[model samples]
Target: MNTIKTIYLILCIFAISFLSRFWMSEWKWYAQFLRLKLKSKEEPDVGFDNKRDADPNKILQEADDIYQLISSTKPLFDIPPFERSTSAHNSKYYIMNPTEVHSTGNLLYTYVETYDYQGNRKTTGGDFFRARIYDKKTLTAAVGSITDFNNGSYLVTFPLYWEGTVYISIKLQYSSEMVSLIHRLRDIDNYRMGFRGIFLSKNYKEMTKCHFNLTFTGPLCDLYYHNSGIKWMCEKPKNLSCENLSSLEYYFNEPSLSEAEKKFDDRKNVLKEIRPVGASSVIVKKQGSNINLPKCQSHPLTYTNSTGFVQNHTWISSLCQVKRFRTSERVIQCIKGKKIYLVGDSTIRQWFEYLVKIIPTLSKVNVGRNQWYSEKLAVDLTNNIYLQWRTHGLPWHPGVPLMLPDSPSAVSLINNIYGGKEFITVICLGAHFTRYPLKVYLETLIHVRNAVKRLLGRSPDTTVILKNGNTRTPYKLLLDNDWLTYELNQAFVAAFMGMNVSLVDAWDLTAAYESAELHPSEEVIKNEVDVLFSYICPNID
Candidate 1:
């Protein structure tokens, strides 16, 4: 009887321990699954226009309503998906540097470091580090927010210019002893691996720190750091032939990865991989000199006190011409009495902001605070047209037609607005569809097209431009570090045709910045908007 009792207790303990570990993993997985499901199902909420004399509860109710509005509205823009590589034994780390350029606005710079065992199918351990930035200056506010974190990427608007250099670092800690146990269990397969980090700083100064440490279970094979920013060590400490970083050529033994994979220079898919071109690199291609476009009256664009921007005096089809398009006048126009509406995503906001700065001839114009949801400018011109922007988030299917009054509120809203005047609706939506399957994206477009058809019944002059989705580093989050901007750009342009809508090839214009940083300079913006401008009003000011 005693022996039987002992066996029963032992079995119960083993079962409980086994279930506990599984429960931990399962709980973690369920939490992640719910979060992702919510993220994928994006819907923004509308805002409440609360009255001035509303009581405290009314305000609170309005706040709740606003939350609902934000919840239902679609996100026009989103960060890249932070997905782990499927390889079980490997681990990947992402390096992010937030940048704010005047032309490119604000953006997060991302670089990836991947580590793997000799032969493993799974990537593991790699986790997110939690940290924050503090502003010591006058604002007395926290500069960074954990709420802005979407998956692995975080949000940062342009830090105020006066804030000075921001003191920023990371806080990371290992979770669960199982990872440590796994490391010990796979001792023979482990090998030393190095990662090259890339990031951009607010200051143009090239100096930066590489903070790291290593744990070893075996004999210390080597230890060295070079001025060339390369480090390596061999079995014997006295022997140091690895200092010649320039001569070091990385060759991949496995056929699955490319030659560029060995070296950290795998970021080029559109352009050939070129070594880091310093300040003195010569330009090999000539810009538009032979184009028949009229030359600008203003030679080498002079800065204007009125607009606080450089004015281009010429009209050329090349990148040089477009970046400088804002030089003389805003290239957008509202017909004397009709509403000119710019609808779709935040990328359209760039166009909206550009139009606001350039169009000076309008007599009466009312501007409101900009929201990611939408922006409106009532222009009193020969044609009293309200220049309006209506933003929709992902799953931007304009909704079903003639289905029911409450079925598609978004489409119903557009139909309600389309009562009388011939509205000029310029739409460019599709950037938020990276994670969404292409079939789903196309189906959404079909719904949108049907809505447009119902609203503006085949009016020839009623212009509708469907700009192909803007291009970005698609697999950046996956550490597939191949920046194939041109290839992807070409693919986007070729893909969208015969939809009976005017196609603006914004991606092609953006390809000029292939070798440049992730952000587009003034040149790239001009090129993109020029296509729209040419489609709308081709004549130079």
Candidate 2:
């Protein structure tokens, strides 16, 4: 009896220890989130209405314009799948200029003519195409710029940056009908994810359905953020008041695509992954060494920004000089005395993760047991380097459920910072926005832009970096497709056209290196951070 009792006690202690750790781990990020919010609440949350005065029609119109700018490919909501699917095997492509030897300084273009399974040339443009010119021997690749002429034909342009035999490849990610179906689904419902709001008080505890959009037919407590005017809703509690809302839990909401939409996201289907109809490769020779490129340092990216190509697995930016801080000592020195703030999707979170890893002196606070969860903080006391990152609001489908307050817009993060020369803010958005509709994205953009305006208004010397969207593969769910990412990025570029903040061209950075993963490889992340710091410490080189 004594031995059995001791064993039971031991098991109880072990279980208690395990659960205590788990509970603490789960709650730390939320604790930090609240602390951060409280510290920054001094900035009046005038709410979202003032900044959201953007003409809805104009914003939607601009969204349409971005699609046309990328390719004359609009979603075919009314078209049938049979008429819209492009046949990869039936399609054909050829080099416009198949000369014996291509010059490094010259321009090369290819015309890809997409066809249906029936070998009929497509009349409307909506095919998802990705092009790259790469040399296997040197491991050099440059993403090809594609122009959909609204007809079946697309113009793929490549700059001959190096002297080598480079092969050209094109892939049809989705058919026009499929793309159209995806768009139609976007307008049908705004709910991508769902949440359960847990309201707690002295004697009552309850959980109610909550979501960014209240598509459910029920009485809901429509609540708005007192400061930013951001709105959120939850099913009305049976007896408890909505004011008792204390915590939130999230669940992944399946896209639930219809039969036609299912074909586009399925890899087993022939409608996707069509990579044929193009010349294998061409050779080129360097003309001269007359190009004296400037460093990567720049204020804001421009239309005519010079994008130097990658050579020998390194990004050589012609936009401005780039100083690669490869060593820990170099990174420390460059970022010393700098308080860097990162917010947005997991991409920005990558920087926070990388920084703490590379710099031994930088210690990450135990914000949460789940490393993947957002709301992170790291401090380098000796260097006076403070680093923090948070995930953006709605449409954020983190593997772990986050409290409502933990999931906030980048605007909230931006507003909280006390900007100065010592502070550097890097915002990487649009990854989550890529899959959202135009109107939703435009409203979010207005909020972010206005927050940036406020940040700059107070501290003009603060260095602001807007990390644009990176290229990602269109997998079973094309939610974060390469084309959609680009479309949203262009919108960001247009939204913050003249803003003081520099919109870092992540598209070119990722594409030039052929980094296509939604969460790209760490090497790509490194290059991106290097590019970001190039502005933070332009003289590091």
Candidate 3:
């Protein structure tokens, strides 16, 4: 009888202990949730007027005039004058000083010098230059930095990634071109810039004179100008625009000049002579070398973290493993029983488009032709998975159809989400707001942060990811250049600090690549998606 009584007592104590631990865990989670909620409440409220004062017609006209100026391919400024030296000079105008071969994960430096037509040294302090290293065997490439000393010298550094012989290429930016870039980065009212290149269809190649403004959004250029007040459309071409657009090589090619003209060698004269000539090769040893490579880790954002290196190509995250859902079955398995909400700009739309193409059964049901901001959905009924995409509220490009009353803001969308282990939400915003004041972007982000905090509070198990803006190729007329995007990305990182959200550092990934494309190439997008999936399924390989 005593043994039975003792057993009962022991069982009673065990039950109480188990309950105590479970309740304690719940209490801690609740405390964190409450803290986040209070922090969100403390954020300042931001509001925007629904009515805009600008006329779309005038903007479109200005865009047309700017397009004509850029297409003419004329120099925007006069060349600088340079005096020819009587003494003999180095025949090689520019010399690339080579550095020792490096292994994977090591930093390699390549130095360059700028000289005039007479072989006299020239200063490129104000000029912008970019360097790239191309792997000979894989044909893959990585971008490098060119730090100018205001003298005749510049230092270029590359983070060695691949093995084998690597060829280096340097592209220099003219001072006049630098002015346009600076304006695009700083000036909020500059609507004349931002068109990178025109897209052309094989069948409609005859349409050369097209005016592009904020309202143009079709894949093919349309002739209708009555309603929009713009005759030409800077359409997003269905096929690759590489063939229709002018190549970088053509823009930066060495200009042919008379012998007498070459002898003068002023700034104007030197500009014609200066070009990115071929340089010596640098070898990168294989990945298994004895060199101690730094392991990539995510650091918490703090006030003291330096923003200077945000644009640097060297700070790449190595933790991202390549993930490919090559088959529809694999995608279905990964996304099954999950609800995903993708909110942001056309860049996020790219992800939606990629999935639609890969998954044969995932058909897009068109909500309406005029409803560009409407919710787009793709469902796999058998797996019970739901995917949705919607544009975030206001300051979006005029190209997007105005939102309906039913449309929700990013904050509202996040708040509406019944977050759970099965829910994933991605927020991406930047390119559209580059032309607006910096304060506007920050206000929007604060509201978004509040919404995210509230959602996480309600459903602590929910996953939220933020995709930062990517780099765009440097084009004089392109308003949404890389420098502006880089600054906006910095603002984005700042706004989301101390929040429980995952950041896919697209800026670093995009800048590190050989291509400075606004809409990065498929290889880059694939890597981004893979990184995203890594967060979604960390337990998977």
Candidate 4:
């Protein structure tokens, strides 16, 4: 009788353990159904929808228990956008340390005074002022650093590099008032852009709208993609259940800001060049040897006072020796028998397009073409070369419909990669995420950072590069301003600071080249890729 009792007890324990495993396996579907109940009227209570996006444990961690690793700006001005929109036309600058002739090794400063479009002398400062010192004859250029006093004054500092007829160009992109408003708008208009939801069943198929906020008056489906902590909801099909929901699509809608609000963003009046009362150009003589650094090798890319500058349209990096791989033979010889993955916005896609355009041996695979946000692949089979470029996950507004099932964050892609010495991954993310909340972008960085850590731990030889955001035309206003990109770049720098990744200072590269374009000229992109090749074929002669 005792032996019989023991056997029964063991059997009961075994059955319970088996059932527990099954319960966890159904956690997602069961949890969704349990929380969702069709009721008498108001939108179904999907309060747990947010919780569903991230793991319960992850939510606690995402509460941010780790050490604070990112540094960013919080715009100081709180006045309305139109109330004190800065006017570059009314701003003026004069030399701080005036001298007959400037010496190469010294630093010089210029002070600026700002005024509002209303002609009121501004008392607080948030002017996005940019300055550059360049000499055209020698083809020498460098980006200057600006210091804002928050008291309606700015100090522009220039380091004399190559001497001889250097012109100072100062551009006041946006005043503090407009920048503060732009910052506020980002937090307020999270759903200014909308998305499409597609669902299907055996005998029923339906298409409806999906978004962070829904207006439909009926049943809704809580959508979750693989392991991503993003909240999305769609209208349930009239005939089919929530389980039939399939994919999501994203695109731009009309601007959410009112005409009154639009007054703050006067694109036509943006980024006026300001000149000094006295001389705007200076004469300088040579001091140092341009700080010629060692060739770009497998080492991490670091930044100096002059991270890099444009000389005769060539990017000279103080951090590494940047080599120009201008021809196909040079590129193919260096990258043959390798796999290159480029991921990010259209800006990064330029790299993919550049490679295929220049390398005659490289023919694009049938992955599709000319779409801004499509996944692309090109191959040079003879040399065993593989290249692919895909846009980063959501918050992405591809002009055309993007299949949601295929959309993935850099973190998702990195997590799935098992790399070798020949495997190279270049990631550039920021322009797309600027419109969302800071928390969302931070969450993305944390996930990507962790994913990168895992990837390196698994494959120590794999190369990972993080390209920072750069200057863009200020005329694009609220969403496409450089100030927003600057904040994102700051967070990016801090998150990837200590990793084994190469942080290309694209900010310096584009600005030094004086490219106000988000998609800079081909020569600029070519120089950018040369920086990439500096890594792939490090220290190449």
Candidate 5:
């Protein structure tokens, strides 16, 4: 009888465990369903029904039209007739000398001259130009420095990295827009131009007296600041300095325009190819294979050890001791049983696009009119892995439809997710918010923080990653610029400090490249995604 009792007890224990597991799984699904139902009721339908054009050619044509509009309207100041020069007017524009480059670790020199349609060199210095050196074989680029002499002449310097055929590319900058950027840089209180931090002091006098540091050290003040200025008076208990502050002089800098220009230019500004007048190619000879390239390690942020930045190029992270999944099979294994939710603007959408391209079986779900803000699900049933991309609520760009029902807030979306060790959340914001006040962005971030906190309170093992906004070439029609995004990125970092989250540091990754673009090249995106994968599956090889 005792032996029979023992067998019954064991069976009862197993039954209870199985029932509990089943209940939890059902609860998660039910919770998500309830939230979706509530959100649908809260958001009113806009009564507009439209579907995105599915024809690839039509999409491409529409993209070209947009690019043309952006490029044609980019110039804040009209090009003076005297500054106009045709390709046929060879003497009107020229590279003064043969491009000279060192084998390695040396600055290459390139001089450019601009002339009127009459072929006379213009003496005024307000014209802007950019330069870059591209490896012929790989097409990889290194952005060159252009120092305007203000005498219709400019000097270009390129950093040598490898031995190969190098092609030079250059572009012109609008003078009026450059001046506006300069003025914005000089204003300390401009939210888009200046740095921001969090100060917790209850003492009103000290808070009012804080001042900004003016030196190089001041820029580094993101993590460290002097106590003497009004900027230094924040309380010590939870004070956190901004990360990745930009110097006032950084506003004037312009990097090369590469594939990003061609990719982002929705309308072809000029029917003809826009090529630099005096194009030249030079061969870079390899110095030594052992030449030491810089390596970046993670640096801890103030207030939390949960996140950090790599002092080296973010690309290096993929090649270093960091583990990477080189095959689809490996990637499947790494992400098995995990669900990833990517939230933000089109930039984050790029990441989703890349994953779809790489994973063959990951198919898109067609939701008709709900496609814009609808969740795109890519499922690998064999691995039980699911990936989703959703647009954040509000401040939608004009490019997106205006009549669609509002999507759930990022915070709300995050809170509703069944977060745990198996869940990953990635978020990026700023490009759309550039036109709004800084306070608006801050309020949005605060809401996100609270949501993140709630998520952690429920599932401390959930991994959250934030991507910083990238820099972009200056365009007057588009109010977004690298400097403005820099401030926004800083605020993003400050808002999440001390939280249990990691940062992808897209700002530094984009800045390190020769091309500083809002949407960086595929190589850069690949690296960014790799860095994210490193966090998601840190032990994967």
Candidate 6:
């Protein structure tokens, strides 16, 4: 009987252990479900109708905690480590077809003048300000933040605050209609249509006695900084300073100044606007320390009179031709000692960077940053072939600093001088200027085409490849129910005379098979890179 009891006890213990394990798992699952339910409430709902257009960034941000945990275990799978190195190099391609759902109006412009602790002009270091803007309307396509303005300065004020000696400046580019709103606001008219919300960067949060001029005056005018939101009651002042005010209370009180005085005060602090200086200083991994200027290996191509300021040239002795869509080795051999180039706005930088990333490390690369001009990256080949990446003559987009043609910014001269080198040059110039009226397009392209003509002289052999707009997703559809890709391409292509330069259809190469329906997929990138290699180094099989 004792032996039987022992056996029965062992069986009972085993059964209890099994039951406890099962119950523990169920409890854990229940806890997970509850957490997910709570999270769903806080996270923004990504469009599920089509997964292709969903934003991976938003999804990743939501699951940040999990990423942190996994990151600690295996650094590779974690987002933080992967992001740090890549983010610096990450850039958008020119072919990105973004839809402008919001009205194209320059609605808001807030200019702030900086003063030091001694009440002198603080022009050397940086200044800080609070700023906020909202997307009043829902945008189907990906919305981009107005990161840096080309008004000439790179220091930007943010809406959020961070610890440290971060100095900030505010710059923006909207539409001319938006700029008009500021004028009306200063006149004491309706202000609702102008700036939607406020934005402030970390740089402003740490400042002490800061004085600035509020350029826009409106019926519902108020000054907000940190937790202090002050409504001004006095008549519009021409100039205002936070320096005299003993506390935040003074900014709330209406200034006892006249309109003319206010205008003068506002003008005193305003300096020249800032512009997007492009990538600051880029360090090519194994190639060199820093680039001095945009330079490349010059390929010899014939100068033909094209519609633009570039020349068209091809290999005199051919290697091979396209056969059943398959490239022959002979065709590859013909492209020896030739270099191609792409120059345009930030979006074009994306396409250019992607090409740079894939090229074999054995190839030579150079990266440079200039204070007055755009960032540059140049690659040299074993042969005399050299390729250059530079952006010049970007037309002003409203709310953003006007890309003044006179402001040491024009590609016409550079292209002409560079043309002396006998080589193929493929140029990409689009976006970065829709805010300017149609006249801006005509004027800008005329200079561009003229530069091409001056460089190519008069020849058919020089190939001036013009790229079309990239494909976009339906989510990017705007109020007009049309994509800017079609419009932008039409405008640019129409401005060009195709006789001398050839147009390489990039829309198909970059965005043909993207599930996002906007940015190119990895596969698409590979294909585009392949095409670029074929054009630049046709001799390499």
Q: Which ten residues in a row have the lowest lDDT in candidate 3?
A: 246-255
Candidate 4: segments with Cα more than 4 A from true spot: 1-83, 201-205, 212-228, 232-238, 241-247, 251-260, 288-290, 297-306, 368-370, 474-476
Better of 2 and 4 by TM-score: 2
RMSD after CA superposition, every candidate: 27.8, 18.1, 19.8, 19.4, 25.8, 26.4
lDDT of 3 by residue, 1-541 (tens): 5654554455455544433543464454435434432443345322121121023443333334322321222222333432322111221212232334567776565555565446666653444444566654564566665444545555566666667787665654333233333433344333433333343355553222222344555554432311112232344455555346321010111333345434332332111222433335766788664444332222332222111111222332443333555567877777878888998877777788788888887878776444445678888787877788977755444343232332446766776798999999999988776664444465566557656766776787888888989877534223445545655775676566556667777765665564567677766676667666656765554
Instruction: Give candidate 1's error at residue 140 in angstroms.
Output: 46
Q: Pick the winner on TM-score between candidates 2 and 5.
A: 2
Best by lDDT: 4
In model 6, which runs have C-alpha deviations exceeding 4 angstroms? 1-335, 361-366, 370-373, 396-410, 413-416, 420-422, 458-461, 473-482, 508-519, 529-541
58-150: candidate 6 lDDT, tens digit per residue? 333333422232111111211121111111011111101111121221111222233322333323211111122222121111111121121
Runs of candidate 2 with Cα error greater than 4 angstroms are 1-72, 202-204, 215-230, 252-261, 269-278, 303-308, 368-370, 473-478, 512-516
Per-residue lDDT over 183-240 for candidate 4, one digit per residue giving the tens place of the 0 to 100 score: 7766566666667766767656688777655778898876554223555577777777
Quality of model 2 by C-alpha lDDT: 0.67
* TM accuracy, model 6: 0.35
lDDT, residue 415, model 6: 47
Preferred candidate (lDDT higher): 2 or 3: 2
Weakest lDDT window of 10 consecutive positions for candidate 2 = 32-41
Clashes of 2: 12
Expressed as tens digits, the lDDT of each residue in 1-541 for candidate 5 is 5654554455355544533544464454435434432332345322111232223343334334322321221332223332343212322222333344447554455555555446666575544343456654564555555454545655565665545676766655333234233323323223332222233324411111112333333223322221100222212222333321211111212322234232222222211222444446667777755444233222222221112122223354322234455457767767889899998877787888788788887776764344544566677777777888876755454333322233445766776798899998888877866654444565566556556666766787888888878767646322455545655775676555445577776765564464556677877787788778877776664
The deviation in Å at residue 156 for candidate 1 is 38
- Winner on lDDT between 1 and 5 is 5
Whole-model Cα lDDT per candidate? 0.33, 0.67, 0.53, 0.70, 0.51, 0.32
Tens-place lDDT digits, model 1, residues 1-541? 5654554455455544444544464455435434432342244211112232123443333334322322221221221111222112232222232222312112222221222223232223222222222233332211211111222222222222122333332222111111222222222222221222222233321211121123433323222221111123222222222221111111112122234232321332122211111111111222233534442121211111011111131223322233234542343341445566666655666666655555665442444332434334556454454576655433222222111111122233344455333455665545533322223333334334444545545343455555544445544322211112222222222222222345554543332223132334545456556655554444444
lDDT (tens digit, per residue) of candidate 2 on 345-443: 888888888888899999988775446654799999998899988776665656565555666667777888889999998877677665556656756
Better of 1 and 2 by lDDT: 2
- How big is the RMSD of model 1? 27.8
Highest TM-score against the true fold, candidate: 2
Candidate 2 vs candidate 6: the TM-score winner is: 2
